[model samples]
Target: MNISVNSLNMPLLECFGSETRVRMIELLSRQPMNIKELADALQLSSAIITKHIQKLEENGIVGTESISGTRGRRKVCYLIPDSIVLQLKAPEPPEEHGGSGYAVSIPVGQYERCSVKPTCGLASENGVIGMVDDPRYFSDPEHVKAKHLWFASGFIEYRIPNYLVGRQTVTSFSLSLELCSEAPGYNEHWPSDITFSLGDTVLGTWTCPGDFGSTPGVHTPKWWKLGTQHGLLKTVTVDERGTYLDGVRLSGLTSADLAIGPGRELLFRIACPDTAEHPGGVSLFGRHFGNYDQEIEVRIGYE
Candidate 1:
């Protein structure tokens, strides 16, 4: 069967293609300013500024509002949109596109009941399972604070979309996820057997059993300790050749043999089965970390 695919697309910026408008955007990014202020900063005539501003406003890039002063007067100023994310309007798919879809399932809530018992440290705002020698903060509602400890018998499940799977002739498929060890203070020595599954088939496994060393986590609460070793595990690439951590590849793998996108939506699942004597757990960082959990994005950019 032949499968057709298209590239990802995002909104187009009307002013983005124009050099004058682009310069105005750069200056406005620094701070909000009125038309006169923008004209003065750009050293452009008011007429020119007004023309560009009109276009920008029409394109939803600039906004204007009135500010009232203590005196019986008000002022009008313009500002750039608070946020701007560029994307393709209709990205074209790979020239050679044919295959099945990919799937992923994660059991995130299951770990809530699991527990870990060790002499190690723990950090939390609600209660203490281990011990957090540092201060704890949960000031932001968007924050996700966890003080969890567990042994070799738990896992989180995630499900990928079936549409992502591609052709049988595909050489390699990458499965990326955000990961880091769960530790307090500092732990550069923690490793665990992390397993991956495609439906019921064991695609492969990796040992995450060790402290991630001392890397800062964005979502990790501010009041908590800093410089705690945490590996921002991402961009994991896998194929018939072998599995990989980030970009570094490993042996014992087969991409051609696995029916990733041949039709039956391929589902990939990760787990830390209790069977492994040495197990490591991971803490997922999300928005509160000043990063996006969904940021651990996956896309089959294939050949």
Candidate 2:
């Protein structure tokens, strides 16, 4: 599971600050355990274990199930998520020259060009758009309604409208979307090297930790099957200083490298290169799917 917060304060600190809780999480990571099992493993009293487990459960970090035992049934505790990703928002820059620019939202499935392989498919909020692992469905007219798409390899490219070039001096370009690594089914440990490119300039690559599943995505449709759920929201940006992922600087490439011009289209591409170490795959989420509520958001900051 992925947890995103504006700050590292409050609930986060309260839940994970204790060394005992940290050790509890480590034990749960390996497998589920009963209260007795946990207390014995950690050498803690039942009361201490119970208290920590309660806190973890309240914060959505742990889950419990009742199973039959010698005395009817007992609760078994396990880690709800194999990993956690903290996405800290970038601090906004001070207002400069009345900051003027335009932003556009692109539907996730409305790509202008794509080269996807098997283990690919598209789905709408209501149901699957077509056959799974079929590339032809990607070109179907109904693709515009897709809230999710995935492939084992290849790329998807979109043409973003250059809305700030003539009217304003564009200083930065930011593209935000929900995505994750893709596995044949679902593998919590699968890693994939996902690359982003603006026109001819490579914006650096991010290794997606896994193809998330087991728990349904926050925004995923109820009709969608459990194992098919995938992706995490990510924001990629290119400003005067450099390119960044979720506010963290990734490369030295800057806005000057993009060379935005009048009547020119900004080509945005997401791909899993053939030479990548992981080469796992990719699953992109849209407004109707994934944990985030938005689609592909392209923002242009100007001066």
Candidate 3:
């Protein structure tokens, strides 16, 4: 998460001021803990720890969920974000497509084609789309309602809706989505090489650092419990220069290579090849599923 240095963010900035809070962060980093456990570990009263946990929750560093226990309901605390990025200043803007561009939000389950392996499944906010780990479920009619999906290997392809009119030259296009490596439950160290492509043009491969379940995603549903919670938001863009992943150059493939013309359909693919050195797998979180509440966003610029 990126937080800029500004007066408006003083409260969040001050989250690190107290040593107690720092210790709280440290303990929670190891694993989720309840009020009594944290209090006992810190040698403080449960009431005191509750106050600290409240502060952490207010600052968005910690999250608390009420669960049943032998005695009664207990509040369990979990870290929120795997990492934080402090931005003293704004970053350089990515190369824009053109003066005029349109953005589209495509659902994660709206894939036009897919080839997947086990440890694969898709779920809507309401429930699982079909039987988990069954490839045939990917073809289920209900798959389009999925808000989250993962696969051990193979690829999912989507058709980007082209809004270009006659003679409107395609200048650039970009796709933004939340992604992470796929693990059985959760693993902070698991890595996967995920590739992005536009039709036949291989945009590039990005190494997902982990399956990331260290904390609950900001927008993840509490009732939905498995292991994986969120992922890093990645944006792949193809412009005049080349293809870029989150503003970092990923390959030499340019917009021309995408062959995005006026009438031609745009097929974008996210893949985790079984041949990759780190064949950890791939997981995608869509709106109401990941840290960032968003769908597979597409921005198409035309002149």
Candidate 4:
């Protein structure tokens, strides 16, 4: 059966109050661990651990299981609930705005306004920035199958809805894009700098290394050129808190002061300066590739 939250009453919050319980929950979040493992890591006695586990199990916050050993004996331990549901008792109605979170893929094959005369480049899925192409690469999704490709800059623009006004706060937001080498016949640790902005406010900037290369990728076409390689420039966590490239935390952006409410819409703007000399661009993996898990999302919680 699917376990669910009973309510958001005082008692419910108390269960997560104790330090031991909090630590236990944190550990379980990584993966399931037996009682001995928990006890050893927490430096608590098995008996003490059992007491805490029993409380968690009673409230359906955790569960226990037994695994039979080769000798027929079994070991009993605890595990966290697979999913968590917060049952809010507020009187607010469900959000009814029209714009919802979405994911879109911009294949080399799909470009909004494209051309091949000057250089080869396609507009990102959302059509935020213009004129994106690299001379070292020419594998348009329109005709050729490409194993490797590159660009000067790749980005998407999103329209944040105006209805989530007072219901919640945009606790977290993120954007993901593919990055690769900028030149042909060149393969080494090439680094490029990228910048992002929200409206007119500069959010954060990152220096990306050219670790991706023409190494026979999964979605690449068979007729792709040999020296084509790429990597993903996934700026996953972007909020008032801070910005992160992939998983490593980068400086700039403060989540604390952001007013991610109903009236304000969000814009994700990215730029790779034309002067990066090594000048490589990005391939945006939207809902199609499933790298960052979200094209763009806003989260809000109410008690």
Q: Candidate 3: worst 10 consecutive residues by lDDT?
A: 90-99
| Candidate 4 C-alpha error for residue 219, in Å | 2.1
Tens digits of lDDT, candidate 3, 1-303: 445577866777888889998999999999999999999998999999988887776555777767899999998887766665565885334333344677778999999999999899998988888898899999999999999999999999999887766677677887888888999987756889999888887888888767877567777888778888888777777898988776677778787666666778789999998999999899999998977678997878777
Weakest lDDT window of 10 consecutive positions for candidate 2: 90-99
lDDT of 1 by residue, 14-102 (tens): 45768888888888777767667778888988789878876665433454444665654432334423343332243233333343323
The residue ranges of model 2 lying beyond 4 angstroms of the native Cα positions read 1-99, 165-167
- Our model 3 lands, by Cα RMSD against the true structure, at 6.8
lDDT of 3: 0.82
Candidate 3 vs 4: which has more lDDT: 3
TM-score result, candidate 4: 0.45
**How does each model score on TM-score?**
0.44, 0.75, 0.71, 0.45
User: CA shift at 140, candidate 2, in angstroms?
Assistant: 0.8
Ranking by TM-score: 2, 3, 4, 1
Summarize candidate 2's per-residue lDDT along 15-63 as a digit string, tens digits: 8889999988898888889998999998989888988887776454666
List all candidate RMSDs to the true structure. 14.8, 5.7, 6.8, 14.4
What are the Cα lDDT values of the candidates? 0.47, 0.79, 0.82, 0.47
Kindly report which residue stretches of model 4 are placed more than 4 angstroms away from their true locations once superposed.
1-119, 123-150, 153-163, 184-186, 275-279, 283-303
Question: How much is the lDDT of residue 247 in candidate 2?
Answer: 68
Model 4, poorest ten-residue lDDT window?
110-119
Clashing pairs in 3: none
